[model samples]
Target: MSDMPATPLLDTVDTPADLRTLKPAELRQLADELRQETISAVGSTGGHLGSGLGVVELTVAIHYVFNTPDDKLVWDVGHQCYPHKILTGRRSRIRTLRQGGGLSGFTKRSESEYDPFGAAHSSTSISAALGFAIANKLSDKPGKGIAVIGDGSMSAGMAYEAMNNAEAAGNRLVVILNDNDMSIAPPVGGLSAYLARMVSSSEYLGLREFAKKTIRKLSKRAHNAAAKAEEYARGMATGGTLFEELGFYYVGPIDGHNLEHLIPVLENVRDSEHGPILVHVVTKKGKGYAPAEAAADKYHGVQKFDVITGAQDKAPPGPPSYQNVFGETLAKLAETDARIVAITAAMPSGTGVDKFAQKHPERAFDVGIAEQHAVTFAAGLAAQGMRPFCAIYSTFLQRAYDQVVHDVAIQNLPVRFAIDRAGLVGADGATHAGSFDVTYLATLPNFVVMAAADEAELAHMTYTAAEHDSGPIAVRYPRGNGTGVPLPAVPQKLEIGKGRVVREGKTVAILSLGTRLGEALKAADALEAKGLSTTVADLRFAKPLDEALIRRLLTTHEVAVSVEEGAIGGLGAHVLTLASDEGLIDAGLKLRTMRLPDTFQDQDSPQKQYDEAGLNAEHIVDTVLKALRWNEASATGGGARA
Candidate 1:
């Protein structure tokens, strides 16, 4: 409440309809108020700040000019949606963002009609926008599709893939290239801005559309020459060489912060009947806020912060984050292994590859927003005898699945996958959850999948993957700080297809995978209090599972339970298959599996998510208790335990 800014102008804006009422001149004040409100809201909630700050004017301009809901305004990645959210009647709940039972950090279609298509991942906006545009065209609906994509997102092949089919949408699709943080931020307020408005205005668009249709009718040779000439001419005139070559009517390099420039150009684009137009609007990543502007990353994502000083609230002092440990360990490992190389898809810092990059910049590759490329590039490196660790988030790895299967797993190439953010990532919810990586990767024939029980286990798995050059190996670890375990002086390579037993007991055995092992230990203590002997084993490898350990535990123990921080058909499913195949379960052994529920879990604390998923200690104890009773009844050949 204290951090909430006094947004008098912004208070007047309840929706895009309300925003549309104000005169064009009044929008500057409104944008300033919106910027302050956005900063205040994010400062209190601690979500995406810098990206929203950068798009204040652009958000104000888009909603003001276009008739939203009717006009599909799709935000690419949704990182900058805070400002848009505030303008679109979600301001009251703005500060509740990323909290338990709160608004999502990214755009969710269910949240509001304003969010036409849900987006958390980058580069899908243009494609979604085209879908909306074509659907509208077919339905004879009275609206167009507008996608606001950032420059960083332009690196993905999907954006170009959308642009290639843009002509078919015809005067219905509008893409606003939000070039906020490009390497070369376009020069502000010059002849380029004036020319952009002139070229993109309603009066000029009719002629431009006619020329586009006329060009399509040309011969291949004539079309190539004409297209090349048009590309260079537009590039010189409006700074859109690449987009023009991709069949988009390019217009911009306009200053996004300049509301006067932004509003008019957007108004022209909205009113025009020209299809598949891309307006490149250049803006700063963190504008207006002094501290954000000064920071290198413009406070892209942040913890709760002081609005005045922009000083973010720091977490309590604890062990280093799993990311930092991964980076440091990889850097250390690279010192001895010259064959080790690192690759990330536009997320060197997020994946902790930046640490390795600092030590071995020559060997590290930050393939920008191109996960498909990153996977294949790593596969190529592995094929040439170099060990390439494709450090990517588990959620992002979904984009390169085909490449992982065809290039790495199918070929049996030894490309190492250092998957960060392995399980229920807080705030980001199901969209960013790393729950399916085990099921997806482990199911592949030559793929070896592993999840870290803790920070120390993560190191051992890292060493193991580097040492083994057999096939594609993926080691998954969760987000946030580690469990402060003492690290070995040097990482050790463990025997594959083997699991270590944490505690030995005869009555009930709890088999654990990934971070769930800690909870399994807690459940063991609880089970012990009830006079039940529980053995806890950390099943480190999800694929090539420790079959001997599984058979031993199931045969010796009356009841066996498998726990994991993954969806169904993951570690537990694999264990069940092995147990059934081995015929060890024929002796009336009660078996149970614990995993995340079938439904998609929403945004909540990691602990709450695990609790809801029945992967926590209490659930584990409950599961074991139920299994124990069932085992007793089955063993006696008739009556219940009680």
Candidate 2:
């Protein structure tokens, strides 16, 4: 229906099997068409673009060579799976990427038989592929587990762990190292491609092995010298001894974008009897598209854009995002508090620490994708009396819970956890949601967990965390733009373990935590119009529970409702537990806890997600009405709990 690019080669094929029928040169043309289609699809939908562009030829090569569906192909992080998704018969739903009830942006097992594994997080592909490879081996299944991992993913300690354990899979595992950034070059195309094949040859493998054994028999000094020389020689040519030492038959450093190079290397690796091989295919991120290639971060993720000029649609100017609020606030605080420092796990920009890094470069640490290390590093800094703010996404913090419990909380160090994306993030979906931080952090002893209801509150809590040097404190805020609430000139230190009543009334008390405070106010307004008196309280601290405030509300109000933008174990559960423990329920208080449902929600609009979670104003009103009616029925002896 649209002026789509003529993809004759691509149109002829719906699956990877169709790719095998095309001529080798035609395959290159198909890759060009696929790249155009990918760019167009992402232009229409605005998902991950740079990553998929970077791996165009590699994806084509793998799918063309390997028998997928039978042979498991796992893409690390799944950001680059768009091209793979298109080739695997998911081309029809490419435009609905990250949308409600559409195809997922990532590879999903439920979406296609071609997707044997699902991935949204980084560095999990190697481990998953190893599992698939080993399981197939144990069951005598005729298939290979091929893992396409990136150089960036290698920075994580988990990738190293998987490589250490890769020997168990024998020759059943195939790891294609999709390296876009590294020291690589060798006189244009064909000659460099030849070196890749030579490095993988049996002659080289035998000679390298022979040299290693021969050198070991020499005198200690000569042995060390010879070993160093051999390593240097191999490193100069192949740059794969590290992988070889880890027990993988290293096979590459090929031109990932060149079909001439990519096809042969991939076919060689596919047919080889070797198990656990690493094919290092060099590529360029955001290849092809001029605008993406020219920009920094390579326009990694984008919004809907004009295809001809490559100008993306910019969001309307509004309040600063919650992430920038945290970053700028932390930076402002760091100016006075000389001890303050910021740490992020490979997400300096993603977590907004880049703003802090700009002014206080010496104080900002980008610890690269190791969340465990980032948490413990912050703890170590805190131990020495340095104020360290460990800025990590709520979902990513799950990776370092052991460190949070052992290193920071157990030691009672004041490592401030600045958690961004604290609620249902829209497009990135359930895997990236910050739904469990309140529940997890509140459960820890000596931990002060606070969720900011607005941008100004975030500033205040940031100040509070800086002043409180007692124990580990965490402040969580959501993903999007702030509520346009005017920021304070200098943040005032909030009273710990306390809450403020925004509106005062007699009949119904609505206790809200985090970003749901606005919805609570709306619900109150709706109730007020219906002649029901409603009171609203912003419970600033999820940990301290605001016991006095909660007790008074519980005793005075006819119905008490707890609401949070987190999962079931969070604010509502804590309030109910507190009310039960204090014996406040003896007054026949009608209590209701509203939270996200038990199941993980799919990617949808933020408003839609909150509605589904029953945290919206309408749901709040419905919940309050239901509680009041239940209380009235009990009073009349018509219905009562056992």
TM-scores for every predicted model: 0.96, 0.94
Q: Residue 574 in candidate 1 has what lDDT?
A: 92
lDDT of 1 by residue, 1-642 (tens): 665678887888899999888988898899889998888888888898888899898888888888898999999999889999888889889989998888999999899999989999999999999999999899999889999999899999999999998889987999989887763448557676788888888777777667767988989788778767866987886677777777777888888888878777887887777657888888888899989889947498999998988899999999878888888899999999999999999888888999999999999999899999999999999999999999999999999999999999989999999999998998889889988899999899988888888999888999999988988899999999899898777999988878999999988899999988889999999877766878999989998999888888988888889988888899888988887887756767789998888988899888888878888899998887776553443434322354
C-alpha lDDT of candidate 2 relative to the true structure: 0.87
Task: Estimate every model's Cα lDDT from 0 to 1.
Answer: 0.87, 0.87
Candidate 2's residue-wise lDDT over 249-298, tens digit each? 77667888888887777776766665578888888888999888888383
Root mean square deviation (Cα) for candidate 2: 3.3
Off by over 4 Å in 1: 183-185, 207-231, 630-640
Clashes of each: 2, 1
Q: Of the candidates shown, which would achieve the greatest TM-score relative to the real structure?
A: 1
Model 1 TM-score (2 dp):
0.96
Taking every candidate in turn, the Cα RMSD to the unseen true structure, in Å, is 2.8, 3.3
